[model samples]
Target: MPAGTPDILACLKGRFIGIEVKKPKGGIVSPLQKLKIKQIQNAGGIAFVANSLEVVKRELSEHNLI
Candidate 1:
């Protein structure tokens, strides 16, 4: 868990995935979030920063991780 951050966790296919959701504008991922994403990847998981539900779907489809 990171300070002042929401639950940046998303799971798919029995794997741990970290997701930092943001708005369509001026959305920025914090440093702690970046670290968390890296940690998730380092732990053999997927991580992403998405702007919208469509963006999430797009990422999942693009990566074939859906």
Candidate 2:
């Protein structure tokens, strides 16, 4: 994986999804990670930082992937 690759990568309904999982407490997103997330989004992919399963589910639902 690349230096800032997201923790989970998936293709749902043909849409690229990148998820960066952080601990619910005190988990920080590094600058590199942030940059990668932005890059993915800019390239028309779905990318986000998630602190919990609920967040991940919500994001997917918002994108109509679930």
- Quick one: how many clashes does candidate 1 have? 0
TM-scores for the candidates? 0.75, 0.97
| lDDT of residue 41 for candidate 1 | 76
lDDT, candidates in the order shown:
0.74, 0.96
- Residues 1-66 of candidate 2 have per-residue lDDT tens digits of 979999999998999999999999999999999999999999999999999999999999999988
> What TM-score does candidate 1 get on C-alpha atoms?
0.75
- Count of steric clashes across candidates, in order: 0, 0
Pairs with steric clashes in candidate 1? none
What range of 10 consecutive residues in model 2 has the weakest lDDT sum?
57-66
Worst ten in a row by lDDT for model 1: 1-10
